[model samples]
Target: MAGVLLSAAVACVLLAGAASASSSSPRVFTVGGVERGWRQPAPGEETYNHWATKNRFHVGDFLHFRYDKNDSVLVVTRDDYKRCGADRPVLRLEGGEARFRLERSGFLYFISGSPGHCDAGQRFTLRVMAQRDNGAASPTEAPAMSPGGSFNSTPGSGSGSTRMPPRGNAGDGKTSGAAPFGAYHAVGAALGVGAALLAFAPPLPATISDPPSTAASFPAASPMASRLRLGQPNPNPGLSPSPGERKGEEGEARKPEPRREVTDLGGGSEVVHIPRFMSRETAWEMFEHLDKRIPWTRPTIRVFGRSVVQPRDTCYVADKGLTDLRYSGHQPHAHSWDDFPVLKDILKEVHEALPGSHFNSLLLNRYKGGSDYVSWHADDEPLYGPTPEIASVTFGCEREFLLRKKPTNTKSQAAGESGETARKRLKASAPQQHSFLLKHGSLLVMRGYTQRDWQHAVPKRARAASTRINLTFRRVLP
Candidate 1:
């Protein structure tokens, strides 16, 4: 009887050791690896879907994310995940590193919280399965330890912390480890539970982008809108209310000064210039935003049979349903127009200010300094049907806009009066020339026969000049 009992105890011990060996240790996946820095999956690389599909996640396994402070990770619902809704995240993870342990046996969604990043295919769905049975493995295994040696929560531990150490490459071997059962229980319970609650149940998501522009804050019956109704110019152009003018009866606030528009060229050719069309603050904001966000390019152009780089940088942002624009022997592919909030707001203001003018595309030009310039040319492309109306908005430093009337063709004198006579007449006629100083925050509208009858250019400045950004909004017919 003593021998049998001893044998039974040994058998139990062997069985427990076998179960422990069979239980798998949790694996760690370095988000985007160390080189990629948790950004959108690169070309030819394994996408989030591809990566997720290849791995089988268990309830106890953790998904680690490592990225820059500017980027973020978001847990969202299936519907929100499909739509790439950055504004309605179920959980938001900031900081350099984050770890989310699979607590339930179901699908979990995640995406980049940055604007437009999610739409760029930076999201993934994870389906986790229940843990397998093992004799040595208990349902109550101790929580995993982070790289910093701190205890991280296990399923139902309620520690709720998402913080983790900075990302390190998996090849280093130091990031892999298995936790002993029932260890770190005291440390795990002490770590607060607020973060865990938020991780499971987040507040209503807020807008991921900046607030609306000042114009959007005004009421429908605002005095500014009433004073600057369509087709009417501000009584006093570029001048604000004086202290005396600001005072009203019984201390009531005075009406804001109206904006003015100066008609540079009238009659057959329409050219209207509105000085300070945008506020200084708004203009600076736009300038900085565009300078940083726009993907500027210096395309190559055919010059006298040899290709040469363009003098200035340019970008084409087009609306939906329009083909890419190619002009001046240069083919620049159009980038899908992203309705950037600020630019959209600015477009609304411009559309409201200009009556009967509709713009569907914008051709942006960046003049880095006095050295960058565009030679005389007319935007008389066939794509822009005859009598095309163009709205040009200027930001940054001031620059000169030169316009000259197209030379008229003289009737052949005496059938064969030596081509010199026609040339002489063309030189003598000398189409009238005009130059306007396009100040910052100004809008210039050119309509009617402007493209057909006149040529415009931003000539190189003789003296030093700061950077300038010009947006020429136009309609491109199919």
Candidate 2:
């Protein structure tokens, strides 16, 4: 009897403290992280499924779907999700965009309502766990809503539309979209007491990747995370390249191979493309290594007085001292070149490609598909100084590289950003002056006044399904 009373007292105190603590914020995620939004996953990209594998979802999280007006999103059960059936949908959302909030645990399914869309791989399932599974909540469950998820109405629709299904327990035969807060408090209180009663239950099943801050958190590092970080032994590291494997690679930093001159933008300004900068085998090895190990992130940036996530993932690596790089107010913390062996090898190749080149900074971009792109902009910053030479190496998928002459009358401002800022201001109104297919294992160089007179962009290719990675080597002024 005394032990029961003690546990009860502890439960009440915990419940009170939790009630006083601020509710955790719900996370909003783009359905598949595709820049083109919720549409058909291109040929090689099983977008939503691919994205789901990389992230963990919890109750109260939001999944946003962005598509054309002609397309609609259907919320369905597991059976419906499998057959691509739209006849009986839990919810049908249209008008270009929609956001759905998870209210329970288990697999939630979504599919395109258009006739042929789901058939072409437009459906995806989200495996959501209890809040505690993410190490962000107490073992007790709590009801949550997104910052503005009170409505079941389609978000981007001008006309209010609700897909609220009929409820069996409600008296009015209709249910309001908003949840009652008082009910949650009462339920939480009851759960806290029940939790105390079952004091010695087995531990919760939160993933190892979850942060170790909550009571239910796992104590060990995630196998995937550990391997990605290079902290532990991984049999198939695939990062280190063997000397014998470098059959056609240069013995040391050498001269550029025969190149195709793309264009000459005037005095000393030229863009040239070089194929086979490194052997095909070397390119493959480097791409595979960097793909799994690089700490890639698609950070949000302030653009045109508003904040938006960058379409592609990026990372920075540089030699000792260099000008700090801030891309539209977000800084990708630079990694030491010493940490990545593959980068050191690539740097040696870049040095050979452009003999006497003092390239010290590297900007890496990983495009998941055609949707991930860089807009038109020049790197005419004080950091690069004047007449900077940039060597760009490619691997994985091939993408179209475009360059256009800057408007003659336009004056140059300090456009220090990588490729996102000057996009809207320097929108390319004229046709592209040169369009080159950047092939795998190829190298491209732009020197002299190219930054002063030309702009470049990688536009979205909806049909492109191949993944691409580009390593752009630049000489950041110390």
Candidate 3:
């Protein structure tokens, strides 16, 4: 009893002041504090060091970076920083912009992953002051210029617990996974005193001498709210029954119960986005498996009386018996859902989320990298009936998902319209647009007249340095 009381006293003393620091809102600091973003500074420049000296970094603060498409940010070791390369990084984020959270304390080195950028002085180092700062500590170093944001993610609304996309750039704008640090803290209120003891423990190392000790886990795909996110993890990652076993699926630990948000885009149209529909781990695993297994091909599509290959690779899989299915003047070879066990499990979850959703067809799209994109258009095909609920799941990397309200006059629109006509409508005038950063393991569901009223697109982002796979589940009517 005496020992327990003594432990409690020590814990109380350690935590007495942390209540406010741990709960404080994290600060976001743009790397180098420069206008040119994360490009290399002048030869052997001092701006990065000057910037580091100017900032007061604490754990939980975010480091934001902006850079070019071909460029990348790397979380490197002290040796790598000196040698001008990171063969093994603590983390690597890509895109035009990115944000990273300082999970713990100690020195952190960041450098450019691009060939010569680091040698030319496109890097910085930071020392996260202990989290228990009393406004009287030695000046600290600032974060390096690297982005590949973790989900929980820009330092995202929370997958890497994390983005600065040029993306999640190890900050260029998309997000990554590794948010368990913040994810665990986000639920701190629910955690008991035993967990708070960590506040006094040694801060996590910021140096990248080796790869991160833990695997990167992202909780994304669903918007944060009363929306449809993925199911939560199975209590703990190391519990008796695995998430797949508990849910009767073959996936890894499921994410939090995804949340869904409905948006009314006029014309009686409704669209929903569950940013956290699926956990990043499960979604990433699915992406890896599907990329190699799915028989993907660049189907030739007729555009405005001219034959042209589609911009991205695609595969059509469905629940058997639905022949005569075609899109854009081409009929893709049909595949069965049974071929991929992961698909079957994901489909089951979709059904559970939308009790009445009857989807039998799946269109798998693979965006090899930044260049692969789908031009603007609606999914208003006759085969899908007037109003269809199409559920879209994204895995691996992040991309811009755009939804635009159609022009008031459909004077030039036509059935089976493909190609230049779509561009004309978009270029005629800038239409009202809504953008969603499609993160890994996220779900976007379009129902009601969303397809008919709003045009959706995954536009080209040259700075996007990652591959992406999207699964659109639909119901084909006979």
Q: Write the per-residue lDDT of candidate 1 for residues 165-250, one digit (tens) a residue.
A: 33322345333123223322322332223223334443423212211111000012233543344212443322333453454454
Task: Please write out the lDDT profile of model 3 over residues 1-478, one tens digit for every residue.
Answer: 5456446645544443244344343566778664767887652233364466457676556677777757778886656766767687756767656766665445577888888777655677765643433432332333333333333223323233123222132333433433334534534442345345435454322221211222122222222210222122221222332333333243333324556787777787777888888654345436655775677899899888999989899988887777557777998888777676557777888888778898999999999989999988998989898998999988887999999987675444633566787767646756789988888988888888988778989999998888899999999997
Candidate 2 residue lDDT tens string, 1-478: 6566656655654554454332244566777664768987554343455456445566455676678888888887656766789998877777877666655445567789899777666776655544422234232332333232333335456224333332321344323232335635654675566456546543333211111111111112344653453223333322223333342343322223445556676767898788767655346545655786678989999888899999899999998777788878788889998777568777876886677898889999999999999998888888898988988999989899888877653226425544655565456444348888888889999989988878888889987697899999999887
TM-score of each: 0.46, 0.43, 0.46
lDDT of 1: 0.62
Write down the worst ten-residue block by lDDT for model 1: 210-219
Alpha carbon deviation, residue 428, candidate 2 (Å): 15
2 in model 3: Cα distance from truth in Å? 34
- The local lDDT score (0 to 100) that residue 31 gets in candidate 2 is 74
Question: How displaced is residue 333 in candidate 1, in Å?
Answer: 1.9
How far out, in Å, is residue 129 in model 2? 56
Q: How far in Å is the alpha carbon of 347 misplaced in model 1? A: 1.3
Off by over 4 Å in 1: 1-258, 264-267, 409-428
- Give per-residue lDDT, candidate 3, residue 111: 86
